[model samples]
Target: MWDTEHNNGVLIYLLVPEHAIEIVADRGLARCVAPGEWQALVSQLAVHLREGRYEEGLAQAVDAVSARQAAHFPRRGAGTAYANELPDAPAVR
Candidate 1:
């Protein structure tokens, strides 16, 4: 998450064994978003996971986070393109 230039990276960690979800946001985003807001997002994702909608839950989570990120750090002008700072593949450890 620290790899991003704007320090707005977000990591949605799902602990399958315990049926838990953790939203980790970089300091830049953490400062802009409230803790309760993040918890609400987590709760929504939890409901989807409990219903066995893993793919949909993950997609929704990504969209939610992306929206928040955009609110804080908007994209450059139309002529400018930015590369993704984080990898698309999830890291399992």
Candidate 2:
């Protein structure tokens, strides 16, 4: 699982374990994870685990990270393919 915050697209990798969860945040090429954030992430993870929806939780976390990345990276015209072969290509463009 990964949680990202800020423009630089910080990526936080989470390792969910039975007893405890491990989290590591990567800021671009650097690492800048705080203890508090780790704790909060762990708490969220625990909730997910207890709910018996680890995959859903992981998907949510990944989406969070992707949202942050998109906000920071801001890909332009990166939606669908440009070729007319694509269904509803005009609509996409």
**Given candidate 1, what's the lDDT at residue 56?**
96
The residue ranges of model 2 lying beyond 4 angstroms of the native Cα positions read 1-18, 29-42, 77-93
lDDT by residue for model 1 (26-88), tens = 999999999998999999999998899989988999999999998999878886777888898
lDDT of 2 by residue, 1-93 (tens): 123333143333444443555544455412333467556656776688789988876666656544644554564685843222213211211
> lDDT of candidate 1 vs native?
0.91
Candidate 2 RMSD to the real structure: 10.8
Worst 10 residues of 2 by lDDT: 84-93
lDDT of residue 61 for candidate 1: 92
**How does model 1 score by TM-score?**
0.93
Q: Give the 10-residue window scoring lowest on summed lDDT in candidate 1.
A: 74-83
Whole-model lDDT for model 2 versus the true structure?
0.50
